[model samples]
Target: MSKPVTDRLLTALQAIQESQGAVSDTALKALSQARSEPLYRLEGLRSFYPVFREIAGAPHRLQICRDGPCRLKGQALAADLQVALDGRQDLDIEMVSCLGLCDCAPASALNETPGPLPDASTVIEWLDNAHWPIPVATNNLQRLPTDPYPGVDCRYGAIKAWRDRPAEDIIREIEAAGLQGLGGAAFPTARKWAFTRAASGEPRTVICNADESEPGTFKDRHLLENAPHLVIEGMLLGGVVIGASLGVIYLRHEYHQARRRIEEALATARGSGVLGPDARGPGLAFDIELFVSPGGYILGEETALLEALEDRRGEPRHKPPFPTTVGLHGGPTLINNVETLAAVTTILARGASWWRAQGRGEHAGLKYICVSGDIKTPQVLCLPWGSTVAEAIEGCGGLSDGRNLLAFSPGGASTPFLPPTAADTPMTFDDLRAAGSGLGTGALFVVGTGRSLADVLLAQAHFFRNESCGKCVPCRVGSAKGVEMAESALEHSPAPIEQALETLHHTLSRTSICGLGQVALLPLVDGLRRFPDEPSLKPLKGFTTGAD
Candidate 1:
């Protein structure tokens, strides 16, 4: 129970007008109504919002993936479900980007609640166990065989404010929640906020990093499209704790709908007095703005994103002035990923103990996983941290065509591969890291029997080679050499292939400027090590081992 922005703004306006002397009530009401109209209209623009609000008391959204790899794996079921549930007055279904759960095609959410089916063997089991009967259609719009949220109250009651009331208290609550950044890097969010708070300055700024251009990842795009207000709330709370006056959401260009939703949400937040000039209760004021990125994967990196915001070329800058100190036109700015920011609002709304109470072991909370690749229902699966890969596959209705799960990328293309034997490992950053891969963005790409390891390596290498910004020589030259080596390996002997891969791996990992160059050889290196039998380098008729 927070006061509506419109009411707060009206009160502020009244006070300002009284201080200035007498003003006509009709004129004041007209201005207030006019300001409020835009937000209402924007809310009405999306048919999903009103229905979601009716049931969840807010815009509760479920984003089902509909991107490239997902589409290849029959993810369109989510879009069909979206159409069927469009005007349902109970649920909001949206076609989201990759959702990082590409390996679990056709994922959906219940309200803003995250996770796979709490407990159920199949789709029918979920529907039968639910309080309400699920809508069923045999056609393309068939409901997913998993419960979006189970054993949890779909009602907003789960989000209760803490008894302690102070900005610092709120920050401490977030710290205790054990929430980590979900935008590829698993850095502690509380520490990130602490940096900004400790920085020497006034008028600090917070930026929501929605520029999700990572290949094979798209959870942020879905969050932006479906729950822009959540992101707004998160930024607002971050601003409140750290004393930031301004907040900006830097979005990627390719996400046109996400940008639109965010712009609309910002307008709603401003007009309603939830953001800008005079927002919410007394002694609290923060404003939010939107800045679209120029659409590049490199821009997703924090330094490059800051540079892009200043209208400069989106390239990595040298750190140690690290964003917390000299960031965004030289100010103490805190930038967090979209998912990380969204989690902050949840942390504030629900106590730190509540968030901490979710997951087990070292993870300590839930993770919003985006599954892609050759899975039956590629979508975003929000599972409690430490859930096994087998559980994730089951959440997505299992693999398509009963194909054997050959190998999978635990993170994005930048991370190393994990063979089927590793699938049983828990899907947490620490666990994945221990298993020789980092959960970089929680992007899972499942490769089946027919998919060649060498081909996959070549495709991923080409992507890195194409995306390298050429700011540093190691990345530019190394990625090219890596691609060349990978392609050459396809037609050469085992020794030549080994030599080329070793050379590329050494240069890329040791001499690169940023994480991009440093990890560019991951796919090749990991694939070679894990699946030695797959890379059969046979010499072509006239080709020699050392020949160009």
Candidate 2:
């Protein structure tokens, strides 16, 4: 007979504890024997969990960006080589969301190698020499047609269509659809539901994190505006899965249009029995309410979002007691990104394996990417995971002036830049990480010719400085110092600029508590590294330092 999973986990934990953090190979083997089921269960722990399945051999998994910005900057080609070589059966192939590495455009990776490179040159050299394979490339995958129901009222369209379906069936369909979260993390939806269902001691709560604060990413707003019902259905389904009676749509304040649309949709869903008690026939008792967030980039972080929901100042909390375990007024809460939950409706409506088969291998499914900056049509494009960045750009009618691309942010402002030399890499998570950047939120900010790298860094620095929540010391003081240094550099004080940059980099990267501070420094650091020829100092127009 097989040992119970919990017992196995306990045994493994005991061995690890006894070894003082260094379990022997034999102990590790025993642990692995015990870990099989937990690992499977853990696979669906969240969107980011399963992607690491392939990289379990390595101590860490690095996800890079091969989306629009990285592609325009030649990350696609580099990613392609990595995918081909790393696509072996033993290795995992994942196409992650953007990692805010557009400044380092054609980035590549050295996964689980541990320790930072001595310098940027060494990192680049290591990437250049890495043995990457040439993945089987394709042009572009076809997009699913928007399924807007005909003759249905705008408010009731989503609810009416799903009204007749059993909540369990809907949830099961979602589970079978193999839909992962789309909010950059790509967590499995079914697993989130299962965890929330089991973990919640009281009535569970569902929150849709619409705080799309990542610069260069606006796909959530598009979904909220155009397909509010889809998002609602997803939330409702989550409520059912977790036995929740209430749901909240936490949207950012700047998304006024989306908020309005969602409000109307909520009213329609409730009035028409798509939501509310006895929704859509009998035994369905779930409803969603809309709440607008006072806009701040930090509020988009999961824990911060929860705090904001509780009417507290928006700031992150310590984890280990993750949101899934305890959240939202000290109850078990399930929070999902706007895009991630939207995909849930489709998953529940469709079958998981069917959804899995929709895209190219590794990047197996559609990814809706928000392409902005330097493009003629800055619109959302839904394509398969393995599609190249060149394909997306061409599909969007190429750059505005056909100018040479300088750098692009594949994952938003925090992501490093990718130059135009690596444009053919596959847009898979593994491929992107192998390239050197991350596939963070799929926001592609393209930088074109004539844009000063220094100016870009300063602008981004100003944003971080303004958005710092004054919570942790690193972010609070580092962002302020960074802005001061950036301004001084703009006024020709190179020493202060360098000092500020170094301090900000260490504080944000090494000590900050959340993804916000860590990623916020990408553009600033990469700008200094990539644009050596660009003037680091600008003369002050009216000041004479010698006279002063």
Candidate 3:
């Protein structure tokens, strides 16, 4: 029999964590000896990833989100619930960063099974009775424009149609469609493929970055669960174009439901000759694998993800030779987000003109946006590119409880918050950026009146601070200190804290190695700049724009 693959350290660690509820010292010692790896390396991994634990805790564990969306919904819900269930012997309750289920604000995961946070009494009752709460259904997939074969059998039609065509032809169509990376970078999709194909490499890699852990972002999860076939076909086409034999979907760990759907779809594809040896043609070989992340927001960063896949701590690498030229295993890697790859299948199946017509004005193709926070009906919507923020809010049934809009986060936590006057801004990257914000990951977090702007802004900073991998000094110290200064500004005088934050933001923006630190203090800085006259923000007046 073939020997088991001992090189997959992260996979082995995940298996141990899954079966034992924690990676105890005993288990790590065994793993170190079995894999012939040092103990310090395993310890580093356990400390870096939040998913890994050194020892098991209470029998039942409940992790509640303490990020932007959940705070907006109910700032004290988690704390109150904790107090109500205090001194419990059998259960443990902890607040964590975004659960990536922002649509269900005040979300909780009971023993890693996510659901809406019920009353404390209900939880206590479940603990006493040993009856676990059923996880809320997360498979609310909507029909999106990117799905070319809607409600029909997914027979890998796009790949079959373009299989025999020249790679140049497929690249040209994608270029004509004006496709760009939808994962906030906005790099040209065709250019990335061309660079990888031309680069001097033997086995290029294609990665679908499904690790969308940004606060208020869950559209990728929706697509993976609903339209897995489209994403699979897109990856296969990319492999064929770039001569890559291996592709991986680096999915986040909390997305258990989406993971199931992807696995089912991958099995169907492999069984039908769409993936495997000779899958691309007579001589070409290509197949895709699903790599669940150990757990961290930094792993969503491209190079950081590369580090994790290679069985190391997830930390972003410096740029000079980008991933397209030098990537996974030191080979050319084409890394695109879930939305970008799924759209590729549509662009190639239907002509480029049809794809262009799906947008409004100058923008091309549809956009998947996750709308959450203070909205009446928080959900994911696949709208035409250039749709205004007001339109998206309308689709979500407007502000919750008939409250008037005060300010809005145009995108995920990294994006700056824009005032209500900017509600008419188009959701495109250029338009939102022109308005002093960005469509980062296309996550819209609505904030209605009466909400504490300072609380919301500080919550965002705390998230970046908490999720920082501490790989570099700038991000490690700066994020934590920035959060401290922001929190102090609320209680103490804001005069001294404003200048300190400005200088710190300047330092982080210039010296940080990755985007996580670069945009760590952006929300607070932007809130102070944009809402200087608001009651909650008046103490921090005269704030200048520095970090963007």
Candidate 4:
């Protein structure tokens, strides 16, 4: 909770943005003085985050979500804004990535605030009045993970269960539950905590990653808004196990609803003595706070998240010293995904045996998979592990009418678009990987039959291209070239798409630093192999390494 430069800048920015719709010069000066840094340094930091604005007396700033889900609605949203903003020098609008409002397609934010602008009418009102409507909080969290909706009556049961237990014993329960990190990697959750516990550092830290911006992945938004207490309890338990005094939730800016819900939960926990000094027991000082992400795709990476948290650009840091060993502001830290943390709370309150009973063979527990796209009713389902993707989709009344599921990204945009044959594959962490896609954030985007796989790949290429951090050449240039080739293939045939993908894979695999480079492999390689006849991929020469 020490005032790092990151917190100072964010605090100043939030205050000014709330009161005046932009970061004013006076507030910038105040932030500079607060951090005791030169104005140039502050300026660089300001420019580093794409969403951060240097206002300059502009009357308004409009942020439109250009992520995959919003793109599904086409450019109508941006086009409408373009028309409204025509000849208005007072208005400054920029197209940005996911706003965590994927549930409501064509989402937008006023200034830096997140909300659902479902139509042009909302946009017009906001443009005229500088404010918009926020939806009501209706889903009262009456259910735990085990039972159906409004499940067991144990509200905050995990916190109460751990009130007198030793931290080591609590950690042991988490390990026994067989819980893994829900954020893409699927690393063992207990192992991550154990590493941080043994690492050499004082005042260890814990972070909850609620910055769920991957397109078609809105489950975290559902969890936070409906069951914020679960994630908070998991964070508190994690704090106790790691001897962490300060915990933070690095929330995405697009989720204003989740932010408000978590804020209320934090207040409730503190008022109930589940946070603050000795939250678990005497001498166990632990608490949690929320830090908003300053809009960037790369910041989803843990190390990059830490870098941004420390008032720097959201770029990947070199490894050999991972987050468990050295993290945050240079302290041993543990960052868990929102779903993983919520699962941790459930596992602690309910025994490991109970959790294991939910899944089959290699997949042992309930997976919070978001079944979206081309479906009658997109939903967040708690399907058993090892459950087929087809089963998950059917739970929500199957695909829309006569449309067949042609392909799907089993786990968000980072995953590969597997054909219908792959739908029978078990939706487990290991099973998905063996099938060539990881159970990333457990969000599935189903593509209907007859949709061009090349068009799908092209959309994804543009995503990776626009969002690449430019920290490494392979990701930056490879993504751009992928976009170019995809576009070219739409009209002409040159080199084989698969060859180029393989060349990029070998070049960017381990060399390009982080997940940005590595994840592009899934869609490209899998697209070529599974979707061989995709017309959007051209047959070109010289695009690949000489061998191909």
Candidate 5:
């Protein structure tokens, strides 16, 4: 028999959450005391997830998305709701930076359910009667392509593909396919598997990051909701190649729909004999469990995610001894984004030739592109490589109401923005960096004619500041200072920021521990670089200067 998911800290917390609507301090205390661990450890785990609470004061907690895409439409909507609900102590309103639902703006999480999607105005009904509508169907697996991960049947394909292939053969197949991480890093996937396979550790682990929290990114949610089986197959293959018997999919709590869908899929898969003990014949044991995060942008970082999974504060681990060698309870571990693994199933099944055929040039294979903000048709599209930003915009019905394109980020929020002049630039990784941004998660948040560029920058700064994990001085202090600068200069000249921003950007990039601080510098620096002639901030001529 497979180990019960509850034996793991993430699932144990899930158990508590399922039984009660919220995870309270009392529950964390009991679990920690029963496990003979320190209370702080449990507290650390309980605190980061926004869905869990320390002091239970309300029957329901509502978290709304204030991410860049959502800000295009939801910011004002949320503000109005806040005014309506003000002074109501029975409810708590939390603004979650990004809910990964750009297509459905003004999205919110009520208690543990994902919603208000098309019915965002329904909050009025909930506020009046404290009654939310039943959650929309999330387990619409029929929406998935019948054979999303080619070669293997979407249902029993993984079990058929594995048939107990040797670890070396499986590893070589992945290497030949030239698969790379679909997350921003784009690191080679096979190389990661090989390192973990060779590392010295008992009971190696595989972790899939389904926390699609990056602003403007939501393709993974579509996949998990439609074709979760494909992702599971990839994890099973990853386990076989790396000698891993344990797999965990750390999902985002706000994605209550995706969470429910994947959970149901896993149970169905186990029943079909594709998962759990006896999954790989008599002696071998391999199974997967699911975990949900409370809420934090920094939690998306792999090591910080591991820390949260182990019921600790989410902090990025220092480098040199990377996760492959010393990760997840000090055992060798393999970490991958959801899309990366989903792609793996297709590649190994159809072979490298099929993957190469899908590409038009050196930039091979299809990428899931999410186009939102000021567009006529906002949707997630899987396009082949070498496609241009202009093309993606065109596919999304070419700007809403034919508004002249203004500035846009080629990828997610962490990347630099490009003016209309660079609209023709290709979406390849190298082309984007050369153009001063990256093809981050292949998402384009096109800013339209009417939106204020300064306001967008300010919104970006607010997200980084609010999401900083407070682990390193560079991000902790730098992001806060950045918020001040952006807010100060939004309505006036941008000059007061020039000198301060230069040093601040350099300090953040050089001294920050992870990408949050480093990427946080982009909006300010890139905003100025893109529009150098924006109104100058009032000069600091009369002020006394401090030593550098």
Candidate 6:
């Protein structure tokens, strides 16, 4: 009936799932009686989240990524693996969405341990030997611009430097640096903190959204794994500015490496008096807790994340009593993503002028770009803001196998894919927006020649469709319908496809409750409008019925 019950519910369910392989009927009944909650509520959670199951699953589960970069690299990996291991009763192979490891194309997790997919023989060998390869934290912190302590031990200097100063001054410094939400929302970071601080509510909370679940976006994961101290310091700084004692990091469950790093960082901070009851001296209490999500892409949406914490189905809530004013447990909440919070620490540790000067041209500050798909070297690059998309491609060693660039999605899946001509566009919010796609999460998904634009575009649309929370009608039905129409267009031909998709996109954008619904069909809808002359799009327009 209260916060404690709600907070422990997901954890308890997870524990049950882990210990027994699933949440059984008798277990749910026992939990309902103990917590005094309705059985239907518990049932709703089990049905909504992908992590929970009604019955025991195979002991060893292999979930292979079938979205975006992974799909482009090896669309048949999961299927082929399934075919190879067909008779194994001890294991189950499932095709899943992104694993936040797009850099390692054709990513898969064996029994919740993530790694790049290997051949069936090697995997079987590992299973036989009782050894599985897992993702390890990459040691590239010194290369990133946002790491204030690059080569040295993190000292939490930012908090000590600004903890005693007026909160307004800290806000002014962040605003002067022109810091915006790096999670693709692009909301001004200073404005968010100020609003949350000014709002009248006790237990005002600060949250770092570590759930970067989109297919082409993994920069946040990199930050969480490599520069966790910066993230922790940033959230502590937020707690100081917002006058909040409690902070939560809503991390996606797939990031096993990141979870360990963050937990270690949190423990280190607490031991050093950087977080806890008297974190910044007496009367100023602040601490952060890491909350791993049960698993869902929609939970990346802020409101949907809140719903999960409240022990409800992870569905997006309607806005306009936004989280800044009415957040967790009816208190004002300040939520920023992993990269955004890390930038906060860097901006504060260094001066605002120093941060502003880090960018190229008129843009301000540094940006982390996740470059993948058809690139010679798939990786994350921390570049100055306003660096052109062409520069990003070059940094990733250009197109794979000397192939020419056909198109590129400047941001993640929700952003529209632009033609090769748009490569020179600067990697800023307004610049990318002007070039026909927004700088979404600073992710660049490049498509090389000889690849089917229709297939690539359809995959992006299907990602959204698969991740939709099904709370609202437009998103749930429209996303599915969009995928269906695109599939039919690719298989056969449809003349009204363009017009129908445009109408559907319009309806979803205007009527859908959250961003998940609003931008579900953006890739396909925009591709139809932008790439009329492309050979792959001809079938979608009913001009040709031949294969792409």
What are the per-residue Cα lDDT tens digits for candidate 4 across 392-432? Answer: 88887888758887888889888888888888888887788
The TM-scores of all predictions, comma-separated, are 0.70, 0.67, 0.96, 0.89, 0.90, 0.97
Which candidate would rank higher by TM-score, 4 or 5?
A: 5
The positional error of residue 12 in candidate 5, measured at the CA in angstroms, is 4.8
Candidate 1 local lDDT, 1-548, one digit each (tens): 12232333323333433343323344444544756544333222222111111122213345444443544444345545555455544344555433333333333334323233121233324433544232311112121111222322331111224222566676677779988888777788888888887887644788898876555786776677666666777777777666777887877654556766788878776776677555524555678766654345677789977765653456789878888877876878888988888777666665677676677676676777777677787767778888888788778887777788988887777878888899998988888889998888877777777655666666677767767777889898888887776675465533345556776788778877678888877777777766655533222112343344
As a whole number from 0 to 100, the lDDT of residue 208 in candidate 3 is 97
Off by over 4 Å in 2: 1-178, 280-284, 495-503, 530-548
lDDT of 2 by residue, 375-433 (tens): 77666777777887777777778887777677666766666767676567666556666
Model 6 agreement with the true structure over 246-326: per-residue lDDT tens digits: 889999988888898899989998888889888755877888878889999999999999998888899988888999999
- Model 3 C-alpha lDDT per residue in residues 159-223, reported as the tens digit of each score: 98998899999999999999999999898999989988888875588899999999999999989
Off by over 4 Å in 3: 1-7, 135-137, 151-154, 541-548
Worst lDDT run of 10 residues, candidate 6, spans 134-143
List runs of model 1 lying over 4 Å from the truth: 1-165, 280-284, 491-495, 535-548
**Residues 1-548 of candidate 5: C-alpha lDDT, one tens digit per residue:** 22345666656776787677667778888888888878786676776655565555666677788879888766777888787777776678887778787766656777646654334356657756867774542434444332344432345564567657777777777777777788889888889998988999765888899887888888888888877777888898888877788898988877777887789879987888788776666666778988777667787899998788666778887886888998888888899988888888777767766776676677667777888888887777777777899999999899885578878998888888888999988888889989988988877998887676767766877888888888999999998997777665554433356667778988999999999998786776678767754432122211222211
Name model 6 segments beyond 4 Å from true: 1-7, 134-143, 150-154, 493-495, 545-548
Ranking by TM-score: 6, 3, 5, 4, 1, 2
Q: Output the better candidate (2/4) by lDDT.
A: 4
lDDT of 4 at 510: 66
Pick by lDDT: 2 or 3, better one: 3
Q: Go through the candidates in order and give each one's C-alpha lDDT.
A: 0.63, 0.60, 0.87, 0.74, 0.76, 0.88
The CA lDDT at 323 in model 1 is: 83
Order of the predicted models by lDDT, top scorer first: 6, 3, 5, 4, 1, 2
TM-score of 6: 0.97
